[model samples]
Target: MGIVVDLNGKREPQPSLEALTRLVAADLKAVNELIVRRMHSPVALIPQLAGHIVAAGGKRLRPVLTLAASRLCGYTGTRHIALAACVEFIHTATLLHDDVVDRSELRRGLASANAVWGNKTSVLVGDFLFARSFELMVEDGSLEVLAILSRASSVIAEGEVAQLVTANDTETGETAYMDVIKAKTAQLFAAACQIGAIVADRPAVEKEALESYGMNLGIAFQLIDDVLDYSAKQAKLGKTVGDDFREGKITLPVILAFRRGSEAERAFWRRTLEDLDQKETDFDKAVGLMGRYQSLEDTIERARHYGAIARDALGIFADGAEKDALIELIDFSIHRAY
Candidate 1:
């Protein structure tokens, strides 16, 4: 049985991305080869730094979505392979830039590119990857693909800027946070999935369905990520628990906790997050407060809601392994925090 009994004696489904990865293994391999080839540069540091993060054990989820979505649409051509590589380059570029912006030392349990090769190098390499992604798009000769990816790129930048504006502000509401993640994270996901249909020359309805599925899944994924930041499981996932809290990131957990707490608890949040006067013990206390208010649980509940929508969005597709794997992906996305 792929089910586990937790401490609460509840049956939990253990879902993995293996099904999707196996289904698209050949295309994924081609995408990987293309990535390696494109990442090469005469400048030694570009490849060195870019390859470091690219090979840092990070699950290529975005590109995998591209492959799976394309397959789901019955696309038999070689177009998706390069497009998948392009999606990965965009995602990888974001990770490099994010690490620099967050001043992060660790990425996927390894030293971050910025931490290893300075911020300037990381940013430049990120730019190089972005350029490579656009090059791939242009080479594909699809104006629609180019437009979708370029728009996603711009939206992702805007989302990053929005998050920066909201960071350290405890008063950042759920609506604002949703906007940030949707723009920053979900937009790329939407573009990736939608491109699959576009390449397949599917109808607008199928394209819209995929876009909806990707957007909802992206939101749920980010929500779980927020929950994981305060979870013990975070270390296992290669991130330091409470990095978000330490950086004064106003995630959903913190937002819920702050909104639901008493005056004293709100004051603690203000002092720690807004004032940035955190004590060493504050992280544990923050987690305790989140537990007290059931903020983490509620956040997971929110993810489930989005996951449901994502699953439903796929209802228009035929019943098959591709659809099953995509649906299970929603389960994996929501349950990974456990």
Candidate 2:
């Protein structure tokens, strides 16, 4: 997210943690400003759709993590800005394509770029953003960074395809679900942090630790996201609840509930998947079944476990405020409201 930490050398209310977060804040803002400026394009339509999606806004968490990882690795250079922007561009492009694939009307509390610009324009602009991201990466001129990010992109695409194929299948279990989340979410998180260390010339051990941290954090983040889709309020959630079900996308909580549910609950799921326009009562019935199955609590515990694993990996780093901040980030992902 556009980090709002104060970088000034002022006495802050939060005491010892302020200064550490402030350093991250300065670096985060610089990276964000650079990405915004570099997002311009000569082709009016391309820039138009790209700008709409970029300005639609997100937490910018991936790029922020990249910058934070660079600072944590003791990198003292401006190149991290371009690299951060590259991560964000790749992320945004994926969101654009995703909205089209999901046929989503809303994102980040606003109209999705595809909803506003049409799928054809949205897809083309997304491709343009992807190409532009590669150009930025090439400018950084690190084969290590290139290799890490390119492979992540490939894996994420594969995950998207796999998820699409398995979307409405009740047979999809935890193993299949984990594969989808790891590819779709964790790949980028791992690459963002790993490449940050790579660009900073950190040792392999530290780099691997950061990659492990990112992967677990990503899994926890996406699992929580899926949980919230079924459990959160509509206004607070920004999107409709039961979206995964409505879209025929089987996520972790639903899968868990279906696996543990009664025969009647299974029949309800069949109807929901086969008929997208199932009654509101059916949605309530499914929600109640999920509760009956304790799927929500199970999902939360799973997310908490992954967050713990992520924090444990962070411990491999030498003691520093950055390491503590990383730990706080894992906690935040587990406890976040939105």
TM-score for all models, in order of appearance:
0.97, 0.91
lDDT of 1 by residue, 42-100 (tens): 99988988889888877789989999999999999999999989999999999999999
How far does residue 126 in candidate 1 sit from its true spot (Å)? 0.6
TM-score of 2: 0.91
The alpha-carbon lDDT assigned to residue 250 of candidate 2 equals: 87
Clashing pairs in 2: 1-59
Per-residue lDDT tens digits for candidate 2, residues 73-154, read 8898888888888999999999999999999998878888889889998888888889988999899998888899889889
lDDT of 2 at 272: 85
